[model samples]
Target: MDKPTGSTVSPQEALIYAMVTLSAVDRQMTDRELRKIGDVVNTLPIFGGFDTDRLVAVAEACATITREEDGLHAVLATIATSLPKKLHETAYALAVEVAAADLHVEQEELRFLELLRDVLDVDSLTAAAIERGARARYRTL
Candidate 1:
């Protein structure tokens, strides 16, 4: 991933990139994680219809977001208010994938997920369920 050069980018794109890159922060961007990211990126209606071009743009934007911001929470907050509830499951699922990618979820990763859930306004129960799913995935791996 490289820094994006676009003069302007959408908040949604930034959030997606933030989430994806953070998932890989533990130094393992697993096939499962990548697939999950791709599914979330393409299947979600956030971009109306995410394409190669959009994916590339979002990837670039995500790189920039990581470099420019301290961490994921700031990026999440930027678009959290407008994010659709339907996608919380996708977001949670993605977070789980990220956490499980390295076979271990760091406290920082957990914190980031917690912040993400908060920012997205996802209920605690849903957040807990997602965390459990991530933990389950790790255990099976």
Candidate 2:
């Protein structure tokens, strides 16, 4: 998705885009996933300075990018270009978190995670750890 202007996407926005993309990957955005996204933005230190109200707009922008021709590719490209190397893992982690939100990992979501991991260049070990952590956090009784 090409931005009309030359301004870069902020780190926090990049993270949000990743989460939103993952949530919408299955073509169905669940309430649990949406709530997890909101909770993450509200509670994470990385988003401490971000305004919560802007989340809907940012997520809508991401959803728009994902609806264009080759939208998934476009969204991944935007994410890869927007995020710095250091925060790539954070992006993947957030994606994993959102995917795990509903306590059910669908095939589409899993594929999206794989695609995201490759795009973010997250090492296998780190990706495994992130996935494990999300599983642990979302575990049932």
Candidate 3:
């Protein structure tokens, strides 16, 4: 799952990596979470030009990076560098969606999301709105 030397990913791929990293942070990636990631990729206009075939590789690269010491920070740095400021909230929203996909946000996921929010520089109000929207979307009667 090692990122190849000097390899870089597109902004869309970086967003996908963020989602995949959150899904796997709890050491379990549920079917619902996986499906949610796929749905986002398939539906988001930001990802419209991305090649689906690269998903596995992007995910693996994220996993590899997260396994290193301070890897989470490294991944966040990569994400920040790849995405424009305007899309920071979008990235945080995607992470929230993936975290809520399994109908439960584990402690690890919560912490990860908090760190992501901080790293992405998403303001509290916006983060709250994004999180609230995801919760509402996944609520069960």
Candidate 4:
């Protein structure tokens, strides 16, 4: 986290960073989580104009920040600043999706999601809906 060198990032990149941070919060980023991030970038209309080539760099940046003291806060602040109000819930949704990617939500991931909800200013009701939607999407028979 060494105070991210840059203060701003595009909304799409901000979303990717959020997902990357959530995936690594448990100190391990699984292939499932990484795949989920790639799926998101490829399918989400929000990312229609985003350059997929930057995914690796964005994830690396997130990983670097997560190692610094209060890096989580720094990363969340960057996410909040980079995304427009309309995409706040989208960001939270993306985090929740990544958290559930492995089908087992770790305590750290849950805490990160809570922090993300608060940082993104997503109301409890909206947060609940987003969380539920992600759960339904990732559900298996």
TM-score of every candidate relative to the true structure: 0.65, 0.92, 0.91, 0.92
Q: Give the per-residue lDDT digits (tens) of candidate 2, residues 1-141.
A: 232122347888889999999999898899999999999999999899899999999999888888899888777887888887888999999999999999998999999999888877888999999999988888999
State the weakest 10-residue window (summed lDDT) of model 2. 1-10
Q: Which stretches of candidate 1 lie over 4 Å from their true place?
A: 1-15, 24-36, 39-48, 69-73
lDDT at residue 103 of model 1 (Cα atoms): 71
Model 4 segments more than 4 A misplaced:
1-6
State the lDDT of candidate 1 residue by residue for 15-56, as single tens digits. Answer: 465457666555556676666667666666664644545676
Name every residue pair that clashes in candidate 4: 1-65, 1-68
Please report the TM-score between candidate 4 and the true structure: 0.92
State residue 99's C-alpha deviation in candidate 3, in Å: 0.8
**Better model by TM-score, 1 or 2?**
2
Whole-model alpha-carbon lDDT for candidate 2: 0.88
Clashing pairs in 1: none
- How would you encode candidate 4's per-residue C-alpha lDDT over 38-93 as one tens digit per residue? 99999989999888898898889888887889898888888988888899999998
> Cα miss at 133, model 2 (Å)?
1.2
